[model samples]
Target: MGKPLSGKVTVVTGGSRGLGREMVLAFAEAGADVVIASRKLDACVALAEEVTKKTGQRALPVACNVGEWEQCENLAEAAYEEFGVVDVLVNNAGMSLLYPSLEQVSEAMFDKVMATNLKGPFRLSALIGTRMAAAGGGSIVNISSIEAAHPEPLAVPYAAAKAGLEALSVGLAHTYGPGVRVNTIRCGPFDTDIAKAWPPELRAELARHTALKRIGGPADIVGAALFFASDASAYCTGATLALDGGFR
Candidate 1:
């Protein structure tokens, strides 16, 4: 038998770092050609080179700011132009800047957050998913956040955007399915670059809420990502998988 994702092509936004980076490597190891899209072209190139060197999978690094609708469209066109069809599309790019209070959240800040977290995914998924349905079948994986369901005051805009993303997954599934599967990964705190800035007390408090008693690692997301990207999740669609270590 072939590798699970052998001969497939995948596009992952935010593929330059953190959980996105891990997923890119995992997909390559599973024998898929990957398109790494992020705002930072240099970072994407670096990771793409690493992926090819390590796994011998073809990697295309493209600079894309998912917050922009045109960029999202260009990203899709670029991916299809290079690989013909995208077997898996992961909408992983997002941002949540800390604010002192909801009142302090500027219109610009809120718009930027929403554009990246919600609007970008909606455009990309609609573009690729529509094509997927017409061409035969494919998978669309959205990276949401636990905050979407359990909002924190510091990042209301982000939470709202993520909540919208979750809704998009379900609606897109209904519209594109039979051939396209849309699902979401509602992630919790993970030990990534962002964690380096977290205060010890805050981290400790976060850990206490998880059943596992600790935050997740970047690697922890690879398995679920692979499952969704490959035939392992053949029967699953319009679902949200919580990879939050049982946050309560």
Candidate 2:
């Protein structure tokens, strides 16, 4: 396919590793100027440089705590200072708490999960929404999880937070329409730290639940991210696409 996202400027959160880094690299490869933000400045910059070296595209690494409103604001401002305007947002930073139930969840664990996975996206989206609205329009892709749809009972808190994230996407799809597009990607268990809690046997067992019978790599969800960020899905919004290696 052509560089469908050429000339666009996209921002990916949590771009230090795993799916976030993969998406950043993918967008750069697709010819988009990419700005990636994460708490780790060193990792972010290294990733940014790697993408530029690999794709010959513009990439900026910014240090920010997306869960904080001020940092989110700075991320938007810095992106504009770098590229003039942002055309796409991938809210991909996340965390998971795999406790047996609500009673087993800690106060800190619950709050942290809600902040990073749900609140952070909300803060960043509001910033991107205003800019995109003024610049005509833009696209937003929220990274959710299949756990929200077909949850692991032990991960009740994570699943619940992700489910809320899905609702947030749907709500924004309408509330910010005419100038913005919002969608969710419900990703399945991937070969990432997010699944490090599972034992080898447990991981394999979970993999068996998917039609593909394997854990997805970091790059597995890039296609969905591309579709949401590019004109290919220009007519799409308020939708959720599962990139779960055929988890069904």
Candidate 3:
């Protein structure tokens, strides 16, 4: 059989590294052209080149900071211009800064987290989803955090923003569906570069919280992302699937 995502055009924000990088590669392997976007143009370009070399699928790299509204618009325009249509949109750009305390968190920091996590998805989904609906249909996969539903004291602003993201996914599904499908993947800790800084003791504690007894790996997310992006989950929408190893 043909590749599941053959002929499809997928856009992934924060596509330079970590989970976003893995998704970008996975989509290309599945036979989809991709748009690699991130704040760092060089990383995006490098990944784009690798994707083309590895998968023979066209990859367009665009420098974009999802925290900025105009940049998000530009990213969409560039993708449409390059690929003509976007079959899958992955809102994966986000950040959670460590603060000494909630009282110590600055306004700028809070806004930055919210803009990247919540507002960016809102704008992108509206921009791409409307076009998808008009043209026929498409899929939007929002990467949320398990903390969105299960908040912790450490990343309060980030948790709130992700919570809002989950809400946006469901709302967009209802608004753009029948033609478009919108869903979310609420993820837990993964063994990505970010976790490299995590203390080993903390990592062990985190593992104990999950049914799997270990944090997820980059490849662990591919199946869930593919299911949502392809026809495998055609009947699903307005749903949130957790890839958190059944964290407690």
Candidate 4:
């Protein structure tokens, strides 16, 4: 059979690093042109060059802070302008800050978390998913966290935002259904750049809690991502798939 994503265009926020980077590379390898977006323009540009060199697929690097409403709108416009159509969008940008205590969590911290994790996705989906519905069909994959379902003290704000993101996915699916698909990937801890700062004991504890006995790796996200982004998931919408290695 032909490549599942051949002739397709995909936009992935946070596409310059970590799990987002993995998905970007995999999509290009699967024969899709890509828009690589992140806060750092240089990183996005570097990865875009690498993508073209390695996969020979077109790559557009866009600098964006998904936390800002105007930036999200600009990103959507840039992607459509360059690619003409976007067949898939992956809302993968997220942030969680370290604060001493819940009482110490300033309004700024909470707002930033909500903006990046929940608000950005909602706006992007509304903008692009509307166009997707009008143009025929598309897929939107939201990257969420296990914390959404199982919140902990250190990440209450982030957890709340992710929970909202999951809810938004369901609503978007209904609002744009028949021509668009929206789904959530509720992820467990992965050994991404952020995990490098985790204490050894904490890492061990996380692994011990998972049925897989280990945290996920960057590449582990590819299978689920491809399935959802391609025609393989044609009938699936308003679904939440746990990609958390059986995190409890």
Each model's Cα RMSD: 0.9, 1.5, 0.7, 0.6
Candidate 1 residues 28-138, lDDT tens each?
Answer: 999999999999999999999999999999999999999999999999999999989999999999999888888888999999999999999999998999999999999
The residue pairs that clash in candidate 4, if any, are none
TM-scores of all models?
A: 0.98, 0.94, 0.99, 0.99
Rank by lDDT, highest first.
4, 1, 3, 2
lDDT of 4 by residue, 89-171 (tens): 99999999999999999999999999999999999999999999999999999999999999999999999999999999999
lDDT of 3 by residue, 44-94 (tens): 999999999998999999999998889989999999999899999999999
Kindly indicate the candidate among 1 and 2 with the higher TM-score: 1
TM-score of 1: 0.98
- Model 2: per-residue Cα lDDT at residue 170: 94
Better of 2 and 4 by lDDT: 4
Write down the lDDT of every candidate, Cα atoms only: 0.95, 0.89, 0.95, 0.96
After TM-score superposition, the amount by which residue 198's alpha carbon in candidate 1 deviates from its true location, in angstroms, is: 0.2
Kindly report which residue stretches of model 3 are placed more than 4 angstroms away from their true locations once superposed.
Answer: none
Q: Which residues of candidate 1, in runs, are more than 4 Å off? A: none
Query: How big is the positional error of residue 104 in model 3, measured in Å on the Cα after superposition?
Result: 0.9
Shift of residue 226 alpha carbon in model 1, Å: 0.8
Whole-model lDDT for model 2 versus the true structure? 0.89
